[model samples]
Every structure is written in C-alpha cells, then in structure tokens.
Target: MLLDAKFTIGQRFKHIRIEKGVSQAQLVDGICSIAVVSQIECDRKYPSAELWGKLADKLGVPLRELIGMQEKQMEVSFQIDMVRVYIDKADHTHALELIDELEQRADLLEHQRIELLICRAECYRTARVFEKVVELLVPFLQNQQIRQNVEDVVLCDTYNKLGNAHYWLNDFEKAYFVFNSLDPDDVHFKISNCRCWNTLGNRG
Candidate 1:
C-alpha cells in the first residue's frame, strides 16, 4: 500500500508553520476558519489540494518541501518502532540486531539519535548488561554535541539509566552520585530517587 504515506499531514503543517514563523490563527487569515486551521494542523483532517497550495504559497516553500519523501528516514523510523516492539517483548538479542542495523542506516535527526541511544541503553539494562549500559551512556553525558541537542527529559533519563546500571553492579556510591546528578523535579529523578534510597538503605 504506498507505505501509508510516511509523512503525516500534521507534521508537514507544523514544520511549515515553524519555518514561516506564523501562528495557526495568523495563517488562517479568514481564508479558512481558525478551527479548521487547528484541525488541519493537528491532522484531524487533510487539507484539499487548493488549501495545501494556499498554505505553501503563504509559507513561501515549495509544496514538495512540506512533504517528506518516503525513503531512508521513514525506513529508519519503522525499524526503530519494530525494535521497540521487540524490546517490549523481552527479545533483547533480536532488538539489538535490529538496532545495530537501524543505527547503520539511520540518518537520524540529532534528537532522534539521542532517543535511539537511550532506547538501546535501556535494552542493555533489561538484559542486565550493566557495564555496556554505562559504556553506551557515559560518553553521551560527556558529549558536548549531545548535550547541545538533547532535551532535558532525555538527559534526565540517561542519568537515571546510568544510575540503575551502577545500582545493578553494586556500585552504590556511583549510583547515588549519578542519581543525584538529575534534577529533583524531574520525573525520572523521582523514579530513580526511590531506587537510590533503597540501594543506600541496603548498602548501609
């Protein structure tokens, strides 16, 4: 089936809107109702070709620029999703193989690469490969490039996973240190806090 169109209409709309620096209300401009614009941007409805052309014109991008080609990036996303499914099923070896292949082919956007690394690290964690998890994640923590591009949630989760690995390896001191590196307000820190306390209690 034509791969169900790799690019979603909403993603295209949002991308174009960001590129144009136009708000949805501004874009509507009475050509369509604001509610209709909101719906279209949210992918509740696909715009007709006429509307799409109007949007492209206003955004000053070629219509093709708004649409993604169903090629390498889409295939990488599909493979990552499949690996997630396998990971959820506790199929670590299969997921690792898939991740290795996807990582080779993945022309991942910066954020996506960080997410994929976190996912792979979690897979290692699940398999009790504590040292491997640490090895995979520590460099990212030290990486200026990753720090520049990674969101706070991804950073926090990386710290939390690294802490878990240390905890598994009986390195309670390092686990405590890594867990403390996360913000107290972060959700991942909250989850890791409980583990940290439990580990500390046992160590004491």
Candidate 2:
C-alpha cells in the first residue's frame, strides 16, 4: 500500500494539539469556529499559513517544523542516502560516524528510533558484521512498545534487515522464515523471498 511521505500540516497540528492537551476551542481562541478547526484537521479544507502559524504558536511546535515537514523529510532521506552511499563505497568509518551522530541525539523520539536502527543495521550489513545486526535488531523486534507503534514500512525494513543478517550467516531456515513474515505486498518481502529460494535452489 502507498503511504504519505510526510504528515499533512493539519495532521502535524493535531498531533501536537493532542500532546499538549489543548482543546479545539482553546486552540482557535475565538479566531475561528471549532468546526473550521476540525475541517482543517481532517484535511478537507485549507488553513492559511498565518492561521497555521497561530495554531503552531499555541501548540508549542516550531512553525517551520510543522509547515516544513516535507522539507525535514527530504533532509532525512538525503542523510540516509548518504549513509547508503558510504556503505557502498566501503567507507564504514564515515557511515558509523553518521549513525553515531543520530544515536547521540538526546531528544530522539520513539518514532525516530526505528529509522536510526535501520540505518545502523544497513551499515553493519555492508560491513558483514552479521552478529552486530542481530544484536541491535532482535531486541527492537521484541520490544512490545516499538512493535505496537511501528510504521508498516519500517516494520518491513526491519524484517528484511534481520533476515539478511541471518541469510549471510548461512542461517537459511531462519532467514526465509523472517522474510515470509513480512507483508506480502511489500517489495522488501518479495525481493528477499526470491533471493532465499534462489539461494536454496542453487545449494540443492
């Protein structure tokens, strides 16, 4: 299934509003009707940038952070792409430096942990550090809290990363099992499944 690349402006507003425990009436502060605010939240209508600024001011999130969500997404994607490039170039040292920077962030939120782990795991995969990947990922997999709230794309990536670690270690049984657990429609699952079968067929 296709997913939105970033949160909608209204969605970012709604999440912060709920987190801050601010009511709709309180948020609008007589500037607009609660119905209008609700419509904005549902993405059925547009809220002017000025109005969004006011809402962001009340919600305690930076206006740029909310309105520029797509910008932030691009920034993050570029960072990850750089890491991947480093790995492909056999520059594990630089890739680890980048991963370490992410790990050092004191305010990393729950939603971001999985993505960071995925990046680090990719570096480890390139380094052929299979045991390190297993060490980092197994606990993430078993974390009830993370599993309960993980995005579908992240979940699929996690499965592929872990399965590949096992696959590279000659643990074909476990590797195929994890690959099979991924969502059938996910590209990660399909690619991993084909590799698993092809490898097994060659061995046979």
Candidate 3:
C-alpha cells in the first residue's frame, strides 16, 4: 500500500482555520456564504481561484502556502515509498541516507515529518541499533506539539515500536510503562503487549 499523507486541501484549510481560532462563519464572513465554508472544509466543494486568494489573505498567509502543501505532500509520499522499498530489501543504509536527506529539508509538513521520523526509527531497529531508535522517537513522543499532530493509528504504531525498542534495550521498566500506556483494547498493540508480558514474566 502507498504511504499517503491523507491531509487534503480541505483538511488543511480546516486545520489552519481552527489553529488560527477562526470560526467557519468568521472564515467566510465577507468572502462567501457561511454554508460554503463548511462545504469547502468538508471538501464537498472547491473554492474558486478568487475565493482561494481571498481566504488566504484573510488567514494572513500567502496564497501559495495554502496550495503548495499538496504538491509537496505528493513528493514526500513518493520519497516515503522509495524508503519503504529500501527498507523491505534490508538496505537500511540507503534508507537512512534518504531519510536523513528528507529530514534536512525544511519544507516537510508535520505529518510528513512524523512519518519520516518513524521510518528512521524503524531503520535503526532493523539494523539492531535499538539505542538509536529510542534516541530518535523518545523525544518526538514527548513533544506535545509534534505528538498531537500524528494520526491515532500512526501514534499507536509508534508507541508499539518505541516500547519494543525499550524492551530490546533491556529497559523492562520503561518498556512496561510504555506498553501499559497504550489503550488496553487497542488491537494494534494487543499482540505486542502479550509478547511483552510473556517476556517480562520469563525474565522475572
């Protein structure tokens, strides 16, 4: 499956609007009907070029800033696909190199940045460099600004990876804590938690 950013123009518009504390009525106050704001944010309707420009102006952002991310997200998605291929082939060196290059670029969106960090951590884990995985993801999870932007599924998987990294590093206490922090009913971590419990029991 392709790694998609999944943040559409409508989602972007809504995200920025909410972040700026702009109500839907406020967003469309002079530009268009308030009902159109919901349509646009829901992606049920696309704004006209004139309306797009006006909305951007009202939001105090450049017009391109609103439209440019879609293009960049496509590019990041393609690059992520390539990284996945390299990783699947066990070419972690190349994967890490590409991930590092992407990391250095300043244009990455929040979701894209989080995806790359998780990819980097996965590479480190596959290379048996668990410390590097912990080093990379621990600080990321701790940062509320960054962590809040991640999708729930991605966040669940990230927590699982981080917990496993801790487990492999023989930091059982930290591993247990991380595992326990996951929702008990989360299907994503159920098997992982079982393994964790079994390992801890054996070690105990």
Question: How far off is residue 180 in model 1, in Å?
Answer: 0.9
Candidate 2 Cα misplacement greater than 4 A, ranges: 1-85, 144-146, 185-189, 199-204
After superposition, the stretches of candidate 1 with alpha carbons farther than 4 Å from their true spots are 1-74, 144-146, 186-188, 202-204
Residue 37 Cα positional deviation in candidate 2, in Å, after optimal superposition = 42
> Model 3 — TM-score against the truth?
0.59
Clashing pairs in 3: none
TM-score of each: 0.59, 0.52, 0.59
lDDT of 1 by residue, 37-141 (tens): 788768787565456556766777654455434212445655566556556656687678767766665366766576678779989998888999999987888
Model 2, residue 77: distance off in Å is 7.9
How displaced is residue 29 in candidate 1, in Å?
45
- The whole-model lDDT of each prediction reads 0.70, 0.69, 0.74
lDDT of 1: 0.70
User: Candidate 3, residues 161-203: lDDT per residue as tens digits?
Assistant: 8888988888888887777777877665454747678657745
Native-structure RMSD, model 2? 14.3
Output the TM-score of candidate 2: 0.52
